[model samples]
Target: MSEVKEMAAKQERQALTGNEAMALAMRQIEPDVVAAYPITPQTEIVQIFSTYVADGLVNTEYVPVESEHSAMSAVVGSAAAGARSMTATSANGLALMWEILYIASGTRLPIVMPVVNRALSGPINIHCDHSDTMGARDSGWIQIFSENAQEAYDNMFQAIRIAEHPDVLLPAMVTTDGFIISHGMEIVNTLDDKTIKDFLGTYKIPRNLLDVDNPITVGPLALQDFYFETKVAQADAMMKAKPVILEIAEEYEKLSGRKYSFFEEYRLDDADVAIVVLGSTAGTAKVVVDNLRKEGIKAGLLKLRVFRPFPYEELKEALKHVDVIGVLDRSDSFASLGGPVFSELRAAMYDMETRPLVTNYVYGLGGRDIDLHMIEQAYRELLEIKETGKVDQYVNYLGVRE
Candidate 1:
């Protein structure tokens, strides 16, 4: 079984949008089913995929669904039938697929989707925010966030691998920052088709209870007694996915020469203060970390690659040596005590024997520019928390004044 196919073609160079990189990677995987509803940013992903289907580059059924709900439903149906399936959607489209999203994971189908991270509508804006993705965090699917075009392209393959890992027979979502990374063109070094085919391998679904010859029931009418077990099984599978996630990432690094982990530490060693962030802001944070290091301020960064499992233990271990930690949340969980990432990090270190002073900073909401200076400001805030043992209750809206 070739987990990932090797590329024989000349190491070719091409300028492609992040959307195109997604299609190119999927072309390599050669999923049997792709059911998608078109939306801005994400639409280009499906459009390019449709072209791949038309050109005979990939042997698959591309379902042009009428809506995102049908799109997710189509993939679920195909997956239940033992097909390697894929899909893509954004804000409203993702919301439309909510019901089927759970069905996909609960039924234990390894479906993969690309969610162009965007803000949900009320006053109506198509801009980027995790509101769409955050709303579905409770869904059983594994969620992975990509910081740039390269990570987005790389994660497309890894998502399939992680989802289909026999122990993790669940759906997965690869979310790229809306417009900032999705629309912005960057050099994404895509692997050769054969290399990807070997990396992801042909999808082999478990002998599902759905097989007619076996005459077994699947997703049957569960009483309250068994419903608990069914959900517990799902939880167990997600928890077990942590190790498999790291293993797949390591394998990709070996095969593709691109290293990845649940989170990447930039200058964390010997640093007294570190700012943890996710998605595109990590790029800006890196610049800030570099400058701060030169200024003799031992600052560092933790860029989250996997958001669903939350990497709690790993996060604690990652920041074990730091004196102060700053968790930057791009999206606000206003109802919560602080931002989402901050809350999670706090919980991760809550029971630790020795924990660093952690502070939460909420920035870059609704496509706000997360500049390097704001990142520097966050580092300063964390330092103050370390020095005075105090922090602010209100989420700091970077680049904004009351």
Candidate 2:
């Protein structure tokens, strides 16, 4: 017989790496399976989780896969078998798992991955950039970006809920800044075991997939006749997921007192211009907005929290009041006329009869530093775009000396 041995209750405060925070979050949730490979800035997350399994903190299957492709494949298998499974990766590791990422989402498996957003290499650099994840943006999974360690931990908690929601039964990616957030240590207010358990409840194993008495086939090979309908079904699931994401975010706010939206608005209500950004760069933009406000200039930050199922309606409403909007794309979209995120936002607002003047400024490419002054420069560039009506085709590399 198994006994219920309890860990001592202690509300101890300490600084923790984003990877450690993510590990603790997974510990609290007690996933049924964890399938992952060792990837830079993401390896520590699974390493710590492995320790928990050794210590008996979590009774689960820990699959140490040979490669990232196998890791993601393991997750799809576990999730389809009706187990709550998770994985983490970055850069080349994400690139390797490209094929399975789509398979997991298309099959409507609720597996979650913490993508430590990193730059792809031509000459080889393992630093922060959204290039890898941005490359997979078209995959059917829901994507959520975290600005810092705390948000990284918080979003991990929410990812499971959002993914498992019946209407949103798709895989999800919770992204954090590579090396920046994943390696940086900070104070994180993690939920207690009881509180987290109450918040998440039991992982409601889906009846169709997990029923042992009624065995069913999953991932059945579909012919060309049924392929189109499967594609449409996946699209319908993603569209339904948007509201479920919002609803779960609201529920998380009620439980933890931290509210998130499709995009987080920082002092944008009265600002003449606001810079939009995702990931840790948004934190830099926030500080710049504060400093700009002190100088009596109306400036603000619009942080994109949800990148996939791109919150078009919510974003349209959020940017309704601003006069000029500057989008800071961390990842460049070559051949797209401008940066990736900016081009998407520009297209979203292009048809709107009453929309703010949108401009694009690309920054922080190849793991570059995005300081407050750089953000200030971006705001000024947007002002120029508004006044002169000229938007640059290439990105405005932040802090570059040219």
Instruction: Name the best candidate (by TM-score).
Output: 1
Poorly placed runs, candidate 1 (over 4 Å): 1-10, 208-211
Candidate 2: residue 102 lDDT (0-100)? 90
Question: Which ten residues in a row are the worst by lDDT in model 1?
Answer: 1-10
Per-candidate clash tally: 13, 0
Per-residue accuracy of model 2 over 1-402 as CA lDDT, tens digit each = 212112112333459988888888888888999988998978999999999999999987999999999999998988888788999999899999999999998888888889998888875888888998999998898999999888888898888998888877889999998889999999876667887778777665455566879888888899998978988998998899888877888887766667887888899888888888898888878888888789898887889999998988778778877878988887788767677788888788887887888777767777888777778888877777767765654455666678
Model 1, span 89-195: residue lDDT tens: 99989999999999898999999999988878775777787888888888998999999888898999999999999999989999888899888888766667777
TM-score of each: 0.94, 0.93
Taking every candidate in turn, the Cα RMSD to the unseen true structure, in Å, is 3.2, 4.8
lDDT score, candidate 2: 0.84
